[model samples]
Target: MTSDQPAATRLSELLGWRKSPDPGLTWAQVEDRLATEVPRGVKDLSLCFPTGSFGGWIHFYNPVQSERALDMFLGRAKTKTENFKYARSLNHAEFPHRFHPEEGGLVAWGHGDQHTYFWSSQPGPESVLYCDDHGDGWGQYPGSVPEFLHALFMDELETEVLYGQWAGCRFFTEFPDYAG
Candidate 1:
């Protein structure tokens, strides 16, 4: 429950996150595939917990999960395909800004029942942000990916902004197959 401890240890103790056995993919591999650089925080995250779901509600997109979702999300920009209609519907410029994947915009790392977590491409004070899917801004989550998860699991963050619909529930983590 302390920031001084390791992020994985804290997550394991607080939220029951377990690493995947697949050795996971590296940042370089993902970047090479995407043809773009990703934040080191996100890289560390994918290494730590690939294809993890939180509270049986939120699913974080890792290399394996992104294998399909990422392509679909990107494909929408080209063919307006229904394969990822959600991507087509997202408008970052709306009241609550989200990931747009163009012009150096934010990118999604995870999504829950009512919220989606994103990492901003634009350099700023904090690296993480989330929107409630509605037109309201829920502000930002501080620290890098691991740091943010540490704080979040330890209940060190504001509940209103961090969990939304998943608030008050005990967190969970697992590595299920990427069905998407």
Candidate 2:
């Protein structure tokens, strides 16, 4: 559960993909490949947004804010007597209607429906910005990623399993048991 153990396990999982013949690739190589191939902005953002298994802590912040949080989290992790490795960033672009490169998906803190969702898409002739899930799905709009980021920093969005529109998207936060 420590950072080193999880890092090694994750690295092994990545390298073990199909069991590559080249033994030269190390964990560092895997990290480099992930950094280069995946979009840095999105990948970094995902790291800031922890999934459900990790108590669903959402720290929304701009680039600067994100770095600050990351540093603090790393520091705290280092101080801990128990070693725990948090989840690594993964590709989450498939749910275009919900997530984006700038502001991460809807993040709200506290119990109940506290999270606010946002999506940029081409609505009719002009592009529009939506507070929650809306629009046909596609295109870009405006709104500082800092807005959502800051809000997330202050609060933790209540994660839930959304059916309907989000059914096909690969990156969804589903509860352990949800009939629907």
Candidate 3:
């Protein structure tokens, strides 16, 4: 056994994964066991770590699939018709809260000192939806829009789906000029 061998062995023991030549046990069997043992729910879901401008973020999806789930979790109507109906009801009822659809999503902005909240049903695959208290305002350090975006993307409550073709994702930070 080599140095790397010990690490692999240790990992296998920790995960109860062993590479035995026995016909009764296969890699696929191990994977199936792991999946079955793990419970499924919105709270248990997770998104891939973000890349590019959005990093260090997490996302989750709703456990149930229904109009109520869409409204409660994503904060958007289940369909365009439902969204229109909701909007119309708000308008006719003269409800204090106003609703609108933007970028193929439902949005509500006017609230007491609260940042505008936008929800899109068609977020790109791997993209998750979330609300940030900071709003779109950009500031230096953790208060910046980029940081907030990162936070929302990384939120544990966001749902993820594989959307859109991947071209490439990249991010870069510039350094201040230094003259000696």
Candidate 4:
């Protein structure tokens, strides 16, 4: 439910993730390039996991690791903005979001099959949010980024928005390789 440990520590102990050997990306670099303030936990995550799959399901983009990945995420977010606006136009009651990049909304951090994870950039209590591809399945996640992940690894965070992408899968650190 909550984590008293540091975000990186919890992530390492639980996921056995290793930080990249290269110099980690700095806040200045991110700000200069992305022009968006990434969450602290997310920054910490890059120090360790950088770019990797979580539980063999979700792929986290490490902005500092590659410009292409960062550009891809930005592009996706931009596209989502237009798409969500169109969805809202269809029916404000059903699709009532302007994406995060619009009016100080949540910033997307990662995504899995049919699900995208976001962090609230607004004031007040911090929390996470996710929306499925259908635009109908949406929900909030409690805790900081690390805590949310801990809950997810422990099978405490519940929702069908992921469309069972993580079903029957235990948390693993890198890409799953069978052929190699």
- Please provide TM-scores, in order, for all candidate models, with all chains considered together: 0.68, 0.21, 0.20, 0.79
Candidate 2's residue-wise lDDT over 1-180, tens digit each? Answer: 233432223322322222212122233433342221222322333333321111132222221223343333333323221111111122224233332222332211112122222323222221222222222222233322323233232242222332122212212132222111
Q: Residue 100 lDDT in model 2?
A: 23
C-alpha displacement of 172 in model 4, angstroms? 4.0
Q: Which parts of model 2 have CA positions greater than 4 angstroms off? A: 1-41, 53-116, 119-129, 132-147, 152-180
lDDT of 1 by residue, 1-180 (tens): 676765655655566556443543445656666555677776556555656576676676565345654454344322322212344367434443433445555666666667666677676654677666554555577777666666665466775654543335556665555433
lDDT of 2: 0.26
2 or 4: which has the higher lDDT? 4
Using lDDT, give the best candidate's number.
4
| Model 3 C-alpha lDDT versus the unseen true structure | 0.26
Cα lDDT of model 4 by residue, 25-116, tens digit: 55687656655567777776666665567886676766666555566557666666676678779878766655665666667777777677
Local distance difference test values of all predictions, in order:
0.57, 0.26, 0.26, 0.65
**What TM-score does prediction 4 earn?**
0.79
Candidate 4 — which residues are off by over 4 angstroms? 1-3, 21-24, 163-168, 173-180
Q: How far is candidate 4 from the true structure (C-alpha RMSD, Å)?
A: 4.3
Which is the winner by TM-score between candidate 1 and candidate 2? 1
TM-score of 1: 0.68
RMSD of each: 4.9, 18.7, 18.3, 4.3
Cα lDDT of candidate 4 equals 0.65
Query: Model 1, stretches more than 4 Å misplaced?
Result: 64-93, 96-100, 124-126, 159-168, 178-180
